[model samples]
Target: MAANVEDFKKRLDEQDLHIRESWVAAMKARIVRGELIKCQRGEGVNHYKHCRDLAEMYTGMIRENKVKGYKIIDTE
Candidate 1:
């Protein structure tokens, strides 16, 4: 019984770590996305030129799976 309880506690701790890691990744992604948006917020046609670096950073982050469920739409 004691071993079972320890196992359950260990599993719960692992789950907590997983949840924290996911949350941290999401928060970091949100900041990165916000920076990219801010860079392009009102640039219009010039956004491509002005925001290229941020866009590249965002794309790299996504490609590296630093965020979930996002992908680069185009490189043109």
Candidate 2:
């Protein structure tokens, strides 16, 4: 029983790490995309839209992972 518990804990830790990595990648993508629009003017509307889209995508991914029985640790 102890071994099984340890194995389960390890798997949960791995899944949490994977989720963290995915979040980092998503954040980097958002930053890179945002930087590409730095020289443009009158892009407030587009920028807001882009950010919203990325936010939605990131949230969707987290929700899907949760539905798959994975717990995302609140590292905040």
Candidate 3:
């Protein structure tokens, strides 16, 4: 048995997540983080930590540039 194929498909459809859209969202997030690092700063004790974290996130996205999910009906 495929274990309730209808239920599985219903759940999957409910999610309605698209891989390309997810990747684009991630890219936009990275761009915002980069903009913060380059164009904003704060006067506080944790300012350095905040900036470092942003930089790390921006670079980390470079290594992780893929969206993972189901690929039904492969056209390739």
- Full-model lDDT for every candidate: 0.76, 0.62, 0.67
- For residues 1-76, write the lDDT of model 3, one tens digit per residue: 5779988887777556566666786877678676765644563566666576666666677667656565567789
Candidate 3: stretches off by over 4 Å: 1-8, 11-15, 18-21, 33-37, 40-51, 72-76
Q: In candidate 1, what residue range of length 10 has the lowest lDDT sum?
A: 63-72
Runs of candidate 1 exceeding 4 Å displacement: 42-44, 62-76
In the order shown, the candidates' Cα RMSDs to the true structure are 8.3, 7.5, 6.8
**lDDT: the better of candidates 1 and 2:** 1
Write down the TM-score for model 1. Answer: 0.68
Q: What is the C-alpha RMSD, rounded to one decimal, of candidate 1? A: 8.3
TM-score of each: 0.68, 0.52, 0.36
How many pairs of residues collide in each model?
Answer: 0, 0, 0
> Mind giving the per-residue lDDT tens digits that candidate 1 earns over 6-68?
998998887777667767876776788898898788787799999998898778766664533
For model 2, residues 1-76, the per-residue Cα lDDT tens digits are 9999999999989998877876776666566445545623346767565566655555565554432325548899
The stretch of ten residues in a row with the least summed lDDT in candidate 2 is 61-70
For model 3, give the 10-residue run with minimal summed lDDT. 36-45
Error of model 2, residue 10, in angstroms: 0.1
| Top-lDDT structure, candidate number | 1
